[model samples]
Target: MCPLFSNLFEIMIPKLDPTVIYEIVVIVFLACWFIATVLCQFRETKISWFIRYKIDLFNLIPLWTFFAPHPGKRDYHLLFRDKITETDYSEWQEMEITEERTFWSWLWNPEKRDKKILSDVVQSLVSSIPSFREKTGNLNLLMFSTPYIIVLHAVSQCKKRSQNCYRQFMLAESSGYQKETKPALILLSVFHQI
Candidate 1:
């Protein structure tokens, strides 16, 4: 027999009691959940805004790649190349309607060309990229949103005014601003009301 198993049997078996095991398990589970909730809430200063803010953890279930800070917004270098701003991001997200349509169509009637599973799998893989450690580095995964939110690094703020016009992607041609013409404009979300 394995030494680990033999040791477990010798030391732990005698103490194992089946009658009260269920109660013990329940107590352990509740304790674990309470601890997790407390930790998530107190992340920033041993007491973070996570708990006070009341975020909907359910909405973040099954993550995706574009769930972090906007790549273009956080990194000035990327934004310079993107040649687009918050307006463009909103437009891009709006354009994603096609993907939704495709998803629905595949849901109703599967087709050979429609590899819907590929998308789900890819997004799931990407969402796993973000971690407590990674947030410290610049490897921001992107959450589909307006460019200005990224530019200002205000993902936490700017919701009331721009709630109506947040998008995930942007089209280069329609964005009205370009990196080549006026790179500075990319940082501003003032083109129009979100």
Candidate 2:
């Protein structure tokens, strides 16, 4: 050891055996690991029970981040819909993902709301739609369908809205088309109101 290090160590722990330092470091590391594991396991149990019961109470607690890291992937989409001249229109809004960015960049950026909160809001909105409720039939189906429908509806709306002239022509050319597209028209109207 350097003279400086030896002098500092001797002053810090006078008359202590050098071997004791290694033992102390190991014990500290193991203790920290055990504590972290216990916290994570406890958090997981709470989260699993909350999800099983479909409880919104989980949001109020907000203890998940203290133990578990946020998920790696974010694949949720936000969708909006509206009807114009008896024709259906839809649009998808881009969602921001901060977790995927570099740690330094994330630290520098302003805080964003949790993705889970956005997902919960979308779930509530989608569940309120009559067609979605009828199609899903239960919580399990709703959970499975929510992401797919949000993405699908968003993409469909973008495609429909992009063809402004074509949409106008189609609407003007056929009164018959409106009858065939009544379900979409109703969905567009309902989602737009929300």
Candidate 3:
């Protein structure tokens, strides 16, 4: 009966090896680290303060390959007013006509495309306006414009989801400028949606 019990125990449970257990632990640790690093780099959700601070510290690692500073889509637009003509161009004509490439399209053909035409136009408008200079002291015009652009994007999305075209146009015009400028040129609002 004792021999039968011993035989059953040996068959049911293999001998445990310390070295094998150590190797498994190392493998599991590496896999977990890799996953954490990937999430830290590319997570869409806002990270907690502690995690962000830890990641910032981890960025000191010279060999670190994962870095996603501004992940996701970034859209920009130009809003200008011609004082001589007393006409406002709320939307950049070029941007209005240009079709946005989908994520799949971009992934399949990852070429250097001329995507910053709107941004360039916005910069030109800012530089041309003397009042803009006074209102924005040494701040890059892009930085000032980004929040407005994001808002416009949100409004456009809301419009699409709710099927409210009037609301879309309303938000486009009424969204205020980041800073009040003298009559030379107002940065106005970014037209993120076509």
Model 2, range 105-149, lDDT digits (tens) per residue? 546744345545555544455545566567676333442455444
TM-scores for all candidates?
Answer: 0.23, 0.29, 0.25
Cα lDDT of model 1 by residue, 67-118, tens digit = 3544322112111112145334322121111132345664575443223332
Candidate 2 stretches greater than 4 Å from native: 1-72, 88-104, 114-116, 119-194
Off by over 4 Å in 3: 1-14, 44-194
Q: What would the C-alpha RMSD of candidate 3 be, to one decimal place?
A: 16.3
Cα misplacement distance, residue 30 of candidate 2 (Å) = 23
- Candidate with maximal lDDT: 2
Pick out the ten consecutive residues of candidate 3 with the lowest summed lDDT: 166-175
Off by over 4 Å in 1: 1-16, 46-100, 103-194
Model 3, global lDDT: 0.43
Candidate 2 global lDDT:
0.43
Ranking by TM-score: 2, 3, 1
lDDT of 3 by residue, 1-194 (tens): 69999899888866558986888899997886666555555333455333446565655322243333533132343222212222533332222413446678846743324334444444444454565466776434643555445434434543132232222222111112434422232344433333
> Clashing pairs in model 1?
42-48, 66-142, 66-143, 67-142, 86-147, 92-169, 92-170, 93-168, 93-169, 165-194
Candidate 3 Cα deviation (angstroms), residue 2: 8.0
Give residue 183's error in model 2 in angstroms: 24
